[model samples]
Target: KERFISLTIKKKQQDVVRFLEANKIEFEEVDITMSEEQRQWMYKNIPPEKKPAQGNPLPPQIFNGNQYCGDYDSFFESKESNTVLSFLGLKPRLASNVVLQLLGQVTVVQ
Candidate 1:
């Protein structure tokens, strides 16, 4: 499913937009630059710990059906790990029974 992205007109935000476009990922963008209310909303909604120390919340704050998926670092990490599909819930979290056993949720007989 598509997701939402909060952004401002900045290099980092632009990079994220370009990344999503290149990947053909569907997303709705909210421009914090145009709306003070939106900016404040973003500031309030995003957890304080996630914000940078010196400024308001940065752009490209991604949301997966209302769940904050994190910023650029986390996003790219997911991409690099090929976990985007899993993050999007497009694929099963555990690809094999071995994962379940590793998590101590199942017993492996071998």
Candidate 2:
């Protein structure tokens, strides 16, 4: 059986995000402007680029939080994320995003 899959690159970030979200698809947004240090980190760890044609790079992750709560504290320190982190204030969203940006270094591609 053969299934056809289409991959279209969108010029605008918001439209790309909206399209995936509206369809319940998922993706990681890699910031083209990341510092060298960050790119090195992603390349060293993630294997997606090894076979760019086949693998969909898995977005960085927050890992399983049920086993690690202290891990949550260290991530929400940044000024931008801190705002959302602080507003949510010790709820699941706090932990969710803290891990999302910190370890994954990702912002849900939105």
Q: 1-110, model 2: which lDDT tens digit per residue?
A: 11221111222234324433564534454452355564454444433433246643323222222122122222223223644233322342323322222322433421
User: What does the lDDT come to for candidate 2?
Assistant: 0.33
Model 2 TM-score relative to the real fold: 0.26
TM-score per prediction, in order, is 0.58, 0.26
Per-residue C-alpha lDDT of model 1 across residues 39-107, encoded as one tens digit per residue: 565566667788889966545565444445566566568778978545443334322111000010111
Report every candidate's CA lDDT: 0.47, 0.33
Q: Estimate candidate 1's alpha-carbon lDDT, on a 0 to 1 scale.
A: 0.47
- Backbone clash total for model 1 is 0
